[model samples]
Target: MDAQPSGRAMVSRGTDTFCATDGRPATHLPVFDGSLPIMTEQPMVIEDSYTGHVSPGSAPQRRTVPGATITKMSVGPMDNNVYLVVCSATGKSVLIDAANEADRVNQLIGEHAPSLDLIVTTHQHGDHWLALEDVAAATRVDTAAHPLDADALPVRPDRLLDDGDTVTVGEVTLDVIHLAGHTPGSVALALTEAGGGRTHLFTGDSLFPGGVGKTADADKFASLLTDVETKLFDRYGDDTVVYPGHGDDTTLGAERPHLGEWRERGW
Candidate 1:
C-alpha cells in the first residue's frame, strides 16, 4: 500500500501565516489571537459493535467476551490489525501483533489496558513487526513467537510458542495452534469460552474472511489448508470468530462452506 501523506494546513493569524498540522482546513477554524483560548482535539469515541471493519486513523472497535475484552485497531501502511486482549477480572492484558505505528499502539495501550503482560507475533513477516521493537522496548513486556520464525524478528522472543502451548493473561488462557504456509511458523491463538458460548480465534494471516493466507506454492497452500481444516475448522464450531492479521474479521461459520473452493483455487 502507498503511504498516506500527513494532513497539513496553513493558518493565517493577523499579518503572519504559519503551517499547522491538522486534518481540518484553516477556513474551518476561527481566527487565532493572543486573547483566544486554545482548542483541543476531542478524543475519538469508540464504537460499541464489532463490525470487523476499521481503517487507519479511525477509532478502535471493541468486543467483550466471557472473561476478556478484545480491542481491534488497524494500523500502518499495510492496514495490519492489532488486537489487545485484556482479562476483565484482573486487567492484565496480552497484545497480538504490534503491527505498526508505535505511537498509535502506545496510545492504545495507555488508554485501554491497565498492564500489558506480553506481545505475541503471529509470524515473521516484516509488516507484522514494524513496531514490535519499539512497543516491546517501551512496554518492557515479554515477547513470544514460534521458534521457526523467531530469528527473523527484530526483537528476540522471550518465549518460543508451540502448538498446544497456552498463553495466559490474568485468568484467561489462549491455546496456540500452529498454521504453517504463509510463513514457516505462522500460528493462531484460540480462546474458548467456559461453556460452549463462543470461541475467538486470532488467526493472524493464516485465515481471513474469504480464504487462507497467501502461500508460495501448491505444497505450502496444501499444508496451510490442511492445518486450518483439521486444527481449526474441524475442532472449532461454526460460531468461532476469526480475527485475521489484516482486513476485516470473520467467523468459521461464514467461511466453512468455502473450504473446498479455496482448496480447488489453490491459494
Candidate 2:
C-alpha cells in the first residue's frame, strides 16, 4: 500500500469539502488469512430506539479500549449509528452523529452520565443531522463540524473543525481526517491513546464495513477512494478499529485488501 502515485486527489461532497474521532482500541479484530470472516458479537450493542429508553428486546453493546469506552447505537428510520466516546480518565464524553430519535439520543448518555463536551456532525446529510438541534439543545454541548458542511446543518457549529485539528475529551485527543465525498465537510476521527497505542476511528459515512459510502458518480467515487486510500488506509495500522455510521464494525486490515475491488466497481 506504499505506492504513492503523485496526483491531486478529487474529494468533495455536494458543494462542500472533506476532512475527518476518538477512543481506545477494543479486542483486536484479527485480519483473516484468506477468507474474510466478519465478527458480530464482541462489542455490545445499545438497544435504545432513540426514545430516551431501551427497546423491549435489545441489549447495550459497550467496548472499552486503551483510554476510552465506546458505545454504538442504531437510531432513526434510516438505522443510522450514533456513538458515544467516553474518556475513561475524566469521564467526559463526545457524541457523534445524533442522527435521529431525539429522546433515544438523549438517553444514551448512560447512568454514570459523564460530562458532555461536544456534539459532532460527521457531515451535513439530513439523516445525520435530523436530531442535531434537539440533541445539542438538550445536552447544551457545543457542536463541532467541518466548515464546508457547517452551513448545511440546522444548528451552526460553535467550532468549525478542519483537518489536523485535535478534539480532546478528558485525556483522549483525536486527530481529524477530512474525507470529502459522500458529503463535503465529511470527517473521521483518529484516537491514539497515550504511548502510541492502537487507534480507534469513528468514521461517519465516509468509509464503511465493506466499502466507501455511496457516491453519486464516477468522479465522486474516485475522490472518495483517493482520500480513503491515501489518508486512512495508507496512514493507519491494520489493527485500527472502525466504527461506522451504520451496519457492523470492521478493521482497516480487513477492509484494505478489498479496496481494489471497490475502485474497479466504481461505486
Candidate 3:
C-alpha cells in the first residue's frame, strides 16, 4: 500500500506510470468490529429513487441529477465546487464544501435554503471548510463528514458519518464514501436522481479528470487508490460522473481511459 513499493509502474488501464497509493493510516479503512466502530469508510447505497430540484440562482444554470436538483457554486481559492443538494419532493437541502465567502453562503442559505438538513464537508482542508462555521451557525443544522475530518468544524458533529452512511436532504439520499487521499479525512458522496438509473460521485480530492491526489506519505496514497479502484470503481461504473473539489467535472469513464496515465503521473 505504500506508494506501490518503489513506484514500479503497473500495467493498468493501458497506461505505464507509477500511480501513488500511499498506505497512510487514514487510507486504511478499519476492519468492522462488532462494537460501535471508531471510524467507518464504507460506501453507501441509495435505498429508493426520488426526484429532486435545484432552484435557479445567479449561476443561471441548473442541472438535474438522478433524484435531486444540483446547484453548483463557484467558491474558494481553488474555486472549489460547492453544491447545494436539494430534494424536489420535500424541499430539503444539504450544503457541500462551504469553503469561504461567508456572505455568499449566508445569502444562498437565507434565500434558497430548504431545511438545511446537513452540512457535509469534503475534507478538513482550509479551502474546503473556511466557511463551515458561518454556514452551520446560520442554518442550525447537523453536520456530516468523514471521521477524520470532523475535527475541522468549530463544533463537533452531532453525529459521525461513515462510508456507507446515508444522508437525506428532503427526500433525496446521498451515500457517503471515504476516499482519504488528499487528506486523511477526504470523503465523497454518491446519489442518483430520479428518471435515471445512473449514479454520480462527488470525489473531493481523491480523484480528478486525469490525475490522482498527490501525497507525501506513500501509505496514504496507496490507501487512496485502493479505495478508488475497489470501493469507487468496483461499485460505480465508468459512466458515473465525478464532481471533484476543484477543476471541471468528469466521469469515471472519462477518467478511466486515463487512469493508468494519471496513476503514473503521481498526481
Candidate 4:
C-alpha cells in the first residue's frame, strides 16, 4: 500500500486494486497477476464520477469529460466550491467563483493552468468572490459576471453576461442561464457536449441538491422557482449534472421530483 498526498491510500491485495480515503474503501477493480488469461485491453474507467466532496485544506477533485476537465476545490469558512474548467484541446481555462483563500486558488491555478483566461464570479456574494480580486490580479485574467451583480463585485466584469449569452473556453462553449432569486444576477453556466452526450450545469447558488437556493421573500422565491422550472428543469433532461456553489453535486433527475415539494414548503 502506498499513501497519496490527497490522503488516499492505494492498496493492492491479491488480484484486486482499490483506493481508500478517510478509511473508506473505494470500488475494487480486478488486476492481473502473473497468471494466464491476462487482459489485452485496458478497462474503461470514468474519472468524472466523483462524489464532489472537498475540505478546506484537502486536495481538489478533477472530472474530465469529452471537451473539458473540471477541477473542484473547497475554500473559506463557508466551504465555497471553486471550479476550474479547462478546455481539453486548447488548454484554455476559466475559474468559476474564486470564492476564498487567494493563496490556495492562485497556487492551484499556477500548478494546473498558469495561463488562466477568465475568472467568472457567479454572483456578488461576498463568500463567492472573497479571493476574486487577488486571483484575478495574480492570473491577470479577465472577469465576468451578470450586470445586475457587477456593481457589487470588487472589480468590474470585463464581460456582462445576460441570459442566453455564450462564453467560450477554447473549443468548448458555455451557455449562461440567468436564474434570479438567490440574487438578482445569479447565473448558471451550462456546457453541453457536441453529440449531446451530457450537459454539465455549474449553478452557483441558484440550484442545489435538495432544492433551489435561499431567497429573501416569497416573491423572490416564486421568481426563482418558476425560472428554475421553466429554464432548467423544462429545458434540460434528467442526466444533466448540476454543480452548485457549495457542497456535493446532483443531477436534474434527482431533484426533479421534489419541485412540487419545494414549492409547497415555500423555501
For TM-score, the strongest prediction is 1
Give lDDT tens digits, candidate 4, residues 151-201: 988889999999999989898899999999999999999999756788999
Q: How many residue pairs clash (N, CA or C atoms closer than 3 angstroms) in each of the candidate models, in the order given?
A: 0, 19, 26, 0
TM-score, per-candidate, Cα-based: 0.85, 0.78, 0.74, 0.81
Q: What is the C-alpha lDDT of each candidate?
A: 0.86, 0.76, 0.67, 0.82
* Sliding window of 10 residues with minimal summed lDDT for model 3: 1-10
Candidate 3 lDDT over 40-131, as tens digits, reads: 32221221232221121224134665567766666544566677777877778988887666656655665555467888888777777777
Pairs with steric clashes in candidate 1: none
Pick by TM-score: 3 or 4, better one: 4
TM-score of 3: 0.74
For residues 182-230, write the lDDT of model 2, one tens digit per residue: 8878999988866798898888989987899998888888998999999
Q: In model 2, where do residues sit more than 4 Å from their true spots?
A: 1-57, 110-112
Which is better, 1 or 4, measured by lDDT? 1
Model 3 Cα displacement at 14 (Å)? 57
- For every candidate, C-alpha RMSD to the true structure in Å: 7.8, 16.9, 19.5, 12.3
Evaluation by TM-score, superior candidate among 2 and 4: 4
State in Å the error of residue 232, model 1.
Answer: 0.3
Whole-model lDDT, model 4: 0.82
- Sum up the clashes in candidate 4: 0
